[model samples]
Target: MKPLLLLDVDGVLNPMSRPTPDFHRYRCTVGAEVYTVHLNPRHGRRLIDLALATGSELVWATTWEEHANEWIAPRIGLPSLPVIPMRPGEPSEHGEMFKTRHVADYVGGRPFVWFDDQVWAEDEEYLRVHQGLADFLLIHVDPGRGLTSRHLGMAHEWLTLTGFSQGS
Candidate 1:
């Protein structure tokens, strides 16, 4: 089975800083409110490169919704990747869990690694229960720095263990 790399935009590819000129700017509306976002295109490119090299299918698991392809993909150099849209009618409070389930469904029988900052114990519990025999790698990004060298190292290790890649 092909392995999947579930990518989250905000804190993973795009650091949630106020302003960063090098990053791609985005705006979204949540019901009555509008918000702006900045995506670190350089880091996004780096992550995309890793995804391509490892032969892992890339799926968008962010609140960007369907806009991930039009707004996020071209900026990051991945235009043709398939996006896993957030679950319909999912409550905003449990968006993280919704994303997790969407990712699981997208990958189907394949192994997967989910990179996100908002994941909690609930998400982990859900994965533990529904993952069945396929390996589910949950990579939690830190608040301030997103994914660090240590985080990547850990992901690399997990990828190796799951036979997604041959570790260096």
Candidate 2:
């Protein structure tokens, strides 16, 4: 089975920081709320390349959910991809981020790499204890810096080392 490349929007793609030259600022409207998003167009190409090289599927694992495909993906040149359903404002039963359990359920024993700002040690422990879960790498992106090339390199290294690459 192909490994999953799970992405989050707020802190992963749309960084919560001062705009840099590499980032373009845009106003995104989700329902009645207007949100300012900073996106780096080059990230789309890099993520696509990583997925192709590693034989993984890109998936949205953000609270933005379906809105990510509509507002964020096109802006970054990413194609519409699968979204992991998230219940916004719902507290997690396990004391980890609410997305933790849902992510485990969504992967269903498939190896995955998740990029998110809110993931913590508790989240990692939750996934580790989850039954029927395959190996996963949870990358904690700094909300201030967003997704950097270093993070991508780490993911690439992990996937290749874990035998989740196409060459494997």
Instruction: Give the candidate number with the greatest lDDT.
Output: 2
Q: Which stretches of candidate 1 lie over 4 Å from their true place?
A: 19-34, 88-96, 131-133, 166-168
RMSD of each: 3.6, 1.1
RMSD of 2: 1.1
lDDT of each: 0.69, 0.92
TM-score for predicted model 2 compared with the true structure: 0.96
Instruction: Give the lDDT of residue 13 in candidate 1.
Output: 67
Steric clash pairs (candidate 1): none
Mark the 10 consecutive residues where model 1 has the least summed lDDT.
Answer: 87-96
Task: Provide backbone clash counts, one per model.
Answer: 0, 0
Question: Which pairs clash in the backbone of model 2?
Answer: none
Q: How far is candidate 1 from the true structure (C-alpha RMSD, Å)?
A: 3.6
lDDT (10s digit) by residue, model 2, range 61-155 = 99889999999999999999999998767777677998998899899989999999999999999999999999999999999889999999999
Error of 2 at 135 (Å): 0.5
Which regions of candidate 2 fall more than 4 Å away from where they truly are?
none
